[model samples]
Target chain A: MSLKRVGNQTVVFAKPPVILSSYSIVGPKEGQGPLGKTFDKVWKDALNGEKSWEVAESKMLQEAMNGAINQASVPKEQIDFMLAGDLLNQIISSNFAARQMALPFIGLYGACSTMALGIAVGSMLIDGGFAQKVLVGVSSHHDTAERQYRLPTEQGAQRAMSAQWTVTGAGSVLLGSDGAGPRVTSATIGRVIDFAVKDVNNMGAAMAPAVADTILNHFHDRQLRPVDYNLIASGDLGAVGLALACELLKQSGMNMGTNFTDCGVMIYDESQDTHSGASGCGCSSVVLAGDILQRIKAGKLKRVMLVGSGALHSPTSALQGESIPGIGHAVVIEG
Target chain B: MADQTQKKPLLSVTAEKYQTLIKQYTPKPTIIKNVVRAFIVGGIICSIGQIFINLFSSFGLARVEASTAATATMIFLGALLTGLGVYDEIGKFGGAGSIVPVTGFANSIVAPAMEFKREGYVMGVGAKLFTVAGPVLVYGITTSIVVGFVYFLLH
Candidate 1:
């Protein structure tokens, strides 16, 4: 058997890329969430003094990139590549941020699964001897995503009870061939799964199956059980998706038990009135950089599996009466 | 519709079965609570419009003029509240109550304008000004014209 290729879809990195540093910045609403204090910086307002919400999102991503580089004590000149993505069309947030950084840019679009996708690609690059250091970043804004995906910011339309609030946040992780932080040990790339879910509001339900698929595949590939990892966190399944995912996993004879929790459900309190919970590309990214990495650094946790689920649907496609297709990618971080 | 049903077989048996499984977990909307809130909020808004009409009539305006002025006042209030970012909250609580009123019409026009203002004046605000309310106006006008043509033939 090849050293890096584990089971069917998993890639066990031979020389695992160490996460040198991670940084997260969130808007005021996210700053008030449960993992609020863990974030490195929080803007008082969503706009962050920008003219538009799109610009504000790009600024957050740029700041996070700079923050991660600075925290790692790595000079900007030494970074080999910048890999990033966001929810905006053409990934404008990452593109705009990359313009200013002037680094070797590789813009990705895995929607909400961007964090895991970025880490997987970045780790592969470092381990393959393609690059020494890679910066992976992602950002999403509530106002920006709302206008793009649903309705205008000030529109008075009532949202469905299953709807999730888009998180306004950005996170960056600096990965290197050698470092002293949590190492990305493996990744499981997911398949695009579609169950013909037509409801645009209930994204959690649409993404739940993909989340279940990736998580199940990860466990099978690694030859491990739920107890093997300190935690198994899904990207942004929210409440409905998380419950559905648990049921699906149980049916498959792989119960996640207490170690399973969703980042979407963990980000907000019940009183937040976010219906299902928080979602977006930023949802998992901020949770990972702000909460998960911090816990790993402090020796409070050891191994973690981050399964990021993404609803790969567009406004145009939905309007054309197409069902939402979901994708998920898994990354294993071990301290 | 026929084409769509014919394409249903493209979905695997597992995909079709999974759809049924997920429906059990999805929460249904509270119909009774929404209906109650809509009724109460809608009644309150009409009452406020009535108060404005009474006030305008007391100032010696004709009954029709007073009613027209009250509607204008409501639209003005809606636009103002929308600008201040308060109408969305009311719309959230009131549901169709706030939406069925004249103020809701005003909001439909102003909301898109504000959202797209970043793209500049002509292509953004002017083009998208009637985006939300356009269909309502189209159907309303088309139905009125049809009614008028039928009335003309009968007369």
Candidate 2:
């Protein structure tokens, strides 16, 4: 079947980059709230310390980014660009991080969708001959997030079965113009999806609509079905969100069945008492950096679509009782 | 508080570190008959956990709390078996299919480190205490962090 390009073909994806280093930092056990240790440091500083959360988060992000870049055995001078983002208001996390990074930078605001969105842009830059070495990564946390949206980390509120476990970590990937990687084969930025569900406790309900619309738009643009890719991965939708997403896709006459897996669902053991499995910006990032990259390196999976869906909301919005406006971006990674 | 200054840290996923100890200490399962025996013993261990869960639930705990208690019970039993060297036999039979359960992980870790208890406090009690649980703590946190970041961004 012939493919129809969705957006302006300013750049056709070539080869992305390999994930040279991955680091995940968890919170205290059964703490009832969490965040990536460094992120929480920044968050706490923002909420309680001399510096803002953005400054703290960005500092930690740079530390993690440096950790990953150092692990890759690449010199700092070799990187061509820096791409980063998170759930902070107006992508301030990445903005602050960019200030410290002092590299050519692009700040993104995808809520939880930063990983895929970041990768998509990085790949485009690599494909369009815009960059040789682009550093892309994302982060999330439980404690800082809880403080931002719901209760304090010490609250110890009872979790519903559908509640998603917010992961505490950061993951970064270094994309270059050439060499070994999963290869950025194709991409589709579907029609922007927005809905009016804003309950902080029910993100799955809030984000599922966009997952449906964005995924459907991508499929329509590509003229491919769910089975075309070996894996149809979604970012940061826990077990319930995954189920809702599959149901919504099925409603569109595509039977994803068992093929659709959520980054939120894949990052943990079922028996971990994590409520509805993993959820975080890092949910997909680590899976992408740690496991998915390994699998791609091993040639086990081909043609994978990492769709990062995010909920754009703030503590003020939650308090003001405003509906959450969510978005999703699809980036295809192939061997 | 105990001075936590010194101790050789154990990496999580260090099953190879316990292999030698297991070979020397664990008794052969040939002393027992068949899967029935293994199942019976495993079943008994599991039953103890189930009873604990029920007991906890009966005391007005929620389902998750009860399950957590049950998990703790199973971990303790596995640790005991590991200490007695019987868990090695069960572990050989069950492989990870059985051992991947949190209880088995607890045993696999605690038994080996506790074996070095005779070496003294720093080596035995303080440092090696985490020999079994250390990696778990590491991976658990790392994994938790991974899951946390992913879900955190989803919002």
Q: What is the C-alpha RMSD of each candidate to the true structure, in Å?
A: 4.9, 20.3
Model 1's CAPRI class is acceptable
lDDT of 2 by residue, A1-335 (tens): 22223432212343445444444333343112322222222222222242433344455566667766776688888888899987665666667767777888888777888888888788777766677888987776554565455532322123455567666556787877767556776666544444555546667656665776677766655567888988888887776667666665665566785668887777666556676677768667766766666667689888788888788777777779887777777887777
Any residue pairs clashing in model 1, and if so which?
none
Top candidate, metric DockQ:
1
- Docking category of candidate 2: incorrect
lDDT of 2 by residue, B1-155 (tens): 11234231111212233233223322243433434554665676677778998999999999999989889878787777677757666664544434556667776466546544445678655665564457778999999999999999998
* Regions more than 4 Å wrong, model 2: A1-11, A14-60, A90-92, B1-155
The sequence of per-residue lDDT tens digits that candidate 1 reaches over residues A29-110 is: 8899888899999999999889999999999999999999999999999999999999999999999999999999999999
What is the DockQ (computed on Cα atoms) for candidate 1?
0.32
Candidate 1 Cα errors over 4 Å, as ranges: A1-3, B1-13
In model 1, state the lDDT of residue A321. 98
The A-chain TM-scores of all the candidates are: 0.99, 0.83
Question: What lDDT is reached at residue B137 by model 1?
Answer: 99
